[model samples]
Target: MIEMFGLEALSNSAQAATTVGIVFTEAIALYIGYGAVTQIVHQATREFLGGE
Candidate 1:
């Protein structure tokens, strides 16, 4: 099964590191994306509320 996935070429530690790196990258991307969305929503709310 591992060979079918082409992951058999990688050592166990290498596979583990790759998984961790992928997860970390995804987390950072989500954090930044959510921050931008939250900022946009907050700004829109403030404008609707007549706040400076």
Candidate 2:
């Protein structure tokens, strides 16, 4: 999969870099999406959780 991106198909350096980049991107996007959802439902979420 990583090799198909015209990148070096190596087990040592390139593969590790690609894997790291993919995981980092995914984690960042997930956090951003959660933040947006939380902001959108800030009031309702507080009420549902018995908060102020």
Candidate 3:
């Protein structure tokens, strides 16, 4: 029984770790995507306004 409990705990830990990793990866991707988009928009706005 103890062994089974330990196995279950380990499995849960692994699943949690995987979930965290996926979320972290997605957050980084989004941050990079938004940064790129913001730069594009900023450049476009500057061009539209005829600013240097």
For every model shown, the clashing-pair count is: 0, 0, 0
lDDT score, candidate 2, position 42: 99
Which regions of candidate 3 are displaced past 4 Å?
1-10
Tell me the RMSD of model 3 versus the true structure: 7.7
* lDDT by residue (tens digit), candidate 3, 1-52: 3243254455767867766776798899999999999999999999999998
Which pairs clash in the backbone of model 1? none
- TM-score for each of the candidates: 0.81, 0.60, 0.79
Best by TM-score: 1
lDDT per residue as tens, model 2, 1-52: 5767656756668788887998899999999999998887997889899998
Query: How would the candidate models be sorted by TM-score, starting from the highest?
Result: 1, 3, 2
Candidate 3 local Cα displacement, residue 5, angstroms: 24
Candidate 2 clash pair list: none
Of 1 and 2, the candidate ranking higher by lDDT = 1
Model 3: weakest 10-residue lDDT segment is: 1-10
Clashes of 3: 0
Total residue pair clashes for candidate 1:
0
Give the per-residue lDDT of model 1 (tens digit) for 14-46.
Answer: 877777777798899999999999999999999
